[model samples]
Target: MDPVRRTPVVVTSALLTLLLTVLIVNLIQPVDAARAERTTAAGASSTSTVSVRRFPKAHHPSKSASSSSATKNQTKQQKPDPAATSAHPVDWLKPSQQVDYPDPAAHPGLSLEVSLQDQRVYVRDGSELLYTMYASTGMDDSTPRGSFRIQNERGDHFYNPREGMGARYYTSFLNHGVFLFHSVPTDSKGGYIKEEADMLGIRPGSHGCIRLTVPDARWIMQSVPTGTPVLVK
Candidate 1:
């Protein structure tokens, strides 16, 4: 059996460079040929046949001469000069994680409010519910009812509902970070599943902070502002 012949993978620009190189070599052939004729006319002895074949130069093209400078610049820019390539490998990769931005001003001067009604969180400014979504709180650790300010906001998370631990968006209203409201698998979307029932009834709930869907988390990040008051109950 014959072994498979692997093909060389040449980048498009490299291939283009090789083509231009060959073309330049071809264009300059006549000049050397003319020079060789002059040498012969001057009574020069014959050198090696290989040497004779090497310098059969021809007339160079003005068109290629003009375009060479532009080609060189293009090649320089297209080639990732090692330093830049090593600096950021994932710069062109697909975005996986979403950034979180918490704002207290979702409701303005009164501050932001996170209320757990039923089994969901009702984000509001004052009396109006800005956004409504499902959540889960601590089974033994009931969500505290208090008015607090957002200490800080995070963009990265690594939460796992299986271990009662992972990444979570924590608000200053809780003892620790567990009260964070991020995303969790829902039992049902709109099947009359309320907040408090699903929140602490089954699975891994929260410590106290308002629980939110992943989408809801991102929404709140955008809607709310930093340094705003967070009233959780």
Candidate 2:
């Protein structure tokens, strides 16, 4: 016979080995993907719970049921690939704004104070913050910075004389009684007298509502309503 070009045993075995390795990798890939997916699911669940508890329920679903239907279709039609889910981008997150504000003004009010020295509010009866907001209490005016109380109580505009300019903060929820803590005054949105402070953390000035930043005002409005005790010492 002519010089036989029979397949060499070594070459044949090498080809077989390569084929088997490829098959094994493909077989285990699904299991790896599943494990990764479980890990991702657990992390997402934990974050969702913390965020959801802090907020009110989403009232008033879409007027169009079709929108929800479309969402369902999108969810069911294609699941994300487990391996790529980690790399998938989620750019937006729910804003971590606070509640527990003095929203119920008509109902009654609480003594609200925003501390310039410690950046804290002191309510009469709570350990953890029952209600809070960033505020500026009588920056320019000698709005007594020590302790005071709801010397009187009423609802009025932010610039109302509010028991006089030099009043002290005390244990009352009046906007400007003995002390001043008003949501409207702290309204960065409503041209509510921006403080002289350069930073935006707490608006840094107040005729008094303790002059909280907008977010802090919102929180105070949500939590401490009228008649809530406040202690500014």
Task: Return the TM-score for each candidate structure.
Answer: 0.39, 0.35
Off-target runs (Cα >4 Å) in candidate 1 are 1-112, 159-164, 167-178, 185-204
For every candidate structure, what is the RMSD over all alpha carbons to the true structure, in angstroms? 30.9, 27.2
lDDT (Cα) of model 2: 0.47
Report RMSD for candidate 1. Answer: 30.9
> Which TM-score value belongs to model 2?
0.35
lDDT (tens digit, per residue) of candidate 2 on 111-208? 54446665455443334434443344555553555544443443434334443232112223544454554442323233433233222233344444
The residue-by-residue lDDT of candidate 1 on 160-217, one tens digit each, is 4565344323333344344455544233322212343333312335554555555565
Would you list the C-alpha lDDT of every candidate in the order shown? 0.51, 0.47
